[model samples]
Target: MIIIAAVDDRNGMMFNHRRQSQDKVLREKILSLTAGKLLWMDHYSAKQFDGCTAPQLNIDDRFMWEAAPGEYCFVEDTSVAHFEKWAEQIILFKWNRKYPGDFCFDIDVQKPEWKLSHTEDFAGSSHEKITMEVYDHA
Candidate 1:
């Protein structure tokens, strides 16, 4: 039930300390949907998220979630459904500590990495393919 959001960098997604775009409707909807669940976020969103009773998960100590060697991670299925239904215009990304980069987390619930599909739709759906780049956070 946590409506997790990350800061979008032109290069990739990050969560150490980045501000969220101002969108009253999106904020309200996020608050409503995440009623009382834990809302994990980076340090940048603390002040903006004021009045939000839900707990904000800050991952400052850990830059990202590292997937096991040869393993991957992503958002949940229901979360994707919520995204497609509510925030279709938005793209989602999960923390990948291992690779240290943003990836297109596919919306396949069957895949264990299926948490939230990194929803990065290009200008056109005909784009051949997209690849993720891993950075050295260490």
Candidate 2:
């Protein structure tokens, strides 16, 4: 499966069961990236995309397990360490700043098994710059 998430510089994903931040451009980017594919996410994560109907969204609490190979999963408030082996690619949208977080991203992209495949920085509605990094498994 393709894992997509938003994080801070420190890899923080959520705080007290809530996401760290949200950006219009980041959400649009995610929608664009997962277009024409099933995008799996939980109910809480779906709230951000209340009015959109372009992407094929699959809502399930067990989204990590439900997502098929080559499918995209928007992870917000979950620990994804256990699902690492099934991930074919990881796309991270970075906030470029730190936020208070209790739940953080588990996998270390610096590890030898993951290769940094692509990166780009763009302006967002809430942030001056949001960086995107795509990693592929070796």
Candidate 3:
């Protein structure tokens, strides 16, 4: 499975049980990237995409275990590092700023087994700029 997420400069994912920030451009980018593909996300994350046209599978806590290979998954409230063994690739959007956050992303993309395959910067509707990084399992 492929994992997609957004993180702050400090690799923070959320604070106060909610996302630290959001960008309309980033949401559109994710939708474009996952078009014609199955996107699996938890029920909470699903709410973020309300009225979206993409095919989404809303699962409970078992999303990680239930996701299949060749699928794309969007995660926010969970630590995705544990899925490394099952993940074929990981796409990360760096918010390029810090915000109040209690939840942190646990994956260390610096690991030798994960290769940084690509990176690009783009402006977001809410953020001035954001960096997108793609890592593939080596």
For every model shown, what is its TM-score relative to the native structure?
0.33, 0.97, 0.93
Each prediction's whole-model lDDT (CA): 0.32, 0.92, 0.86
Candidate 2 backbone clash number: 0
Q: Tens digit of lDDT per residue, candidate 3, span 12-83?
A: 999999998888899889888887777788888878777876655555666777778878888899888778
- Off-target runs (Cα >4 Å) in candidate 2 are none
Residue-by-residue lDDT tens digits, candidate 1, 72-124: 11232112332332222222332222323333232333333334433432221
Pick the winner on TM-score between candidates 2 and 3. Answer: 2
lDDT (tens digit, per residue) of candidate 2 on 1-138? 999999998999998888899998888899988889999999999999999886488889999989999999999887899999999999999999989988999999899999999999999999999999999999
Provide the global lDDT of candidate 3 against the true structure: 0.86
Name the weakest run of 10 consecutive residues (lDDT summed) in model 2: 50-59
Misplaced by over 4 Å in model 1 are 1-3, 6-20, 51-112, 115-138
RMSD (CA, Å), candidate 1 to true, equals 13.0
Give the lDDT of residue 122 in candidate 1.
20
